[model samples]
Target: MESKMVIRQSIGFPRLVKWPRRVGYAAALWSLIFGALGLYWVLGGDGFPFGENDPRGQMMGSYLANLSVHVGGTMIALTGFLGIFAALAMVRKWNQKRLYFLLLFYAWVMCAILLFIIPDSRILQNVAYLFMFYFDLIDWIVIHQVFCMIGGVLWGTTALAYYRISRDACGNCGRAGEGASIISASKWGKVFTYCAVLTALPYGIVRFAWAIGIPLGTENIAIIGDFSGEAILGGLCFGGAILTLALIQKWGEVFPRWCLFIAGKRIPIWLVVIPATSVSVIIFLTGLKVSPQVVMMIINGEITMKNWGEMVPTLSWLPWGLSLGIATIAYYLRRRSRCKHCGKF
Candidate 1:
């Protein structure tokens, strides 16, 4: 009740955001398409996408390669099946209450699983890369991640919209507080926002120093890959932290004076929502390596928890993911005018 009350008290105005119906439709359409392809592959007699006596298998090693080929395939097929209902739930007019609720529930559950439980198991495969190879389009691990990325965006955003429309209509309400900040999140949202910003800076600074040939941790530069790549990716992460401010600041709603093309114009909500929502998934995927992975290794006696050097830095993934996700949801709610159930300001 306090949570509900907080939402009601937070919004004292009658402004509304223009929900991106077109994006929702596109996601829905793709969900069905991707889901069908997945179902076909799963049911088909063909072997999994990777694995077997393939040259590509050599890149990721035996354990991780086989895992992706087998376990990842199963996950892909399951995600594809859910994608069908997820697409259908995007409809505001869908009459079947149970199905509608179920779809929303499934999307949220899958997102959590993707974000927390079975995080993109690409770390072992990535052990080969000196720098992050996540954006590499050709890698099989990257390919599987790409599917998860797309599905997460569609599932996460569609569920966000559903809850925005009808409070009781869907069990998955996207974020912590309902009737939350569609423009800017609540107090918790701000906390997470700052947390993300602060955590991102360390990586950016470290990478920048490394890029400039300033030896901080290593004496030999030969060990590092294109320092420029680290600098660039790190910069992107750092820059993303700045973008999170848009959730709390007016500049997010209006153009910063820098872009003369559309200065002071209201930035399209989709522009922020789409990227922010998608990044949240990646944040979790990356964070998983630190938290659960380390714990599992310790549990299995692969490593000792006492020598926790990378642990602290790695834990940043959780806050980054949480803050980004919360802030985006808050931004959506803050800007949107109508409530799902009340249908009133």
Candidate 2:
């Protein structure tokens, strides 16, 4: 029987495992660096402005022109990148491990660009549409559904891979094969639960309103055409939330009642761990990419884009307010925990 390894003090990052984690870290770091550059361009007014007369008045010149899209997008992407780092740091081995987390992170990178960044960018919109048109012309392609199709496929594949991995015994198990649930707190589980709630609740409210024929405002349109997308998004939110909650009490560690043949059986770490880690990694890197943009905007008020005021509500204040609130709560929570190393908290 293999002897159990005890992980004590934090080992140097390089001493850890290879592949995904290392690749994830590199990606995250790159994003952080470039996101800063984008932010600098937006804030410094290095010729990117909003005035119609302003030759640089492309996307940044409209009602949607806001720093949040660029900066917020980077932050979202960076968060996923960080998730990857966390997963790699936590895991012990990587044999035939699925790359769901990494792929999800990539999808998130696309989301940050599409959801928050590109929607507001005239340049990006034109570029994207141009490509879409060309691609569609070359082949029979539903350009409008590209993002959804790609994201759905990635997430779907990851989810199925995770289910398969859960059946295999965890490599990190002890000699007697004690499971990860018995040994460590599931950070990925907790984080995933939190993310789903954060993203789904708000998105759900908007989606539900669209479902019954309600509108957030005159301009806000339902992204999900018909109820199919609404159902899928809502389902992902609900399912992910349920699994996370179950993990809190170890129910998820063992497959739940609905997994057919695998129901009521012990699940593998790679199953949940891989997907969770993949999503996190992707999210963290993407978030890192946007982080610089956020910081830059906050530092300098030089958004040369037109209709900057139109974006004040959502991009600038709302997310900042939420971030501040979350920070405060996190600080208090950490303080209450009284962790020895958490001096500031």
Task: Provide the TM-score for each candidate, comma-separated.
Answer: 0.63, 0.35
For residue 221, what is the lDDT in candidate 1? Answer: 62
Could you give the C-alpha RMSD of every candidate to the true structure, in order shown? 7.8, 15.3
Task: Write candidate 1's Cα lDDT for 1-345 as tens digits.
Answer: 433543563354323333324445656666666566556655664544455623454332223344544455566666766666566656564667787688678878765654444435353234324345554534654555556556566666666777655553322233324454433345666776787788666656655666776654444566355576668756766788898888878898778889899897667666888778767756655665456655666578755443333233456666777778877877776765444434444
Question: Residue by residue across 1-345, what tens digits does model 2's lDDT show?
Answer: 011111121123334323322343444344354345445544543422223323322323233234344454445345545534533332333343455455445545544443333222232223333533533322111232233233333333333333333444321111123223321233443453454445434434444444555544324353423465444444543454455444345564567687889797655434555454333333233233344554466468643243222222223223322332332223222212111122111
Worst 10 residues of 1 by lDDT: 168-177
**Worst-scoring 10-residue span by lDDT in model 2:** 1-10
Off by over 4 Å in 2: 1-196, 217-225, 285-345
lDDT of predicted model 2? 0.37
For each candidate, what is the lDDT? 0.59, 0.37
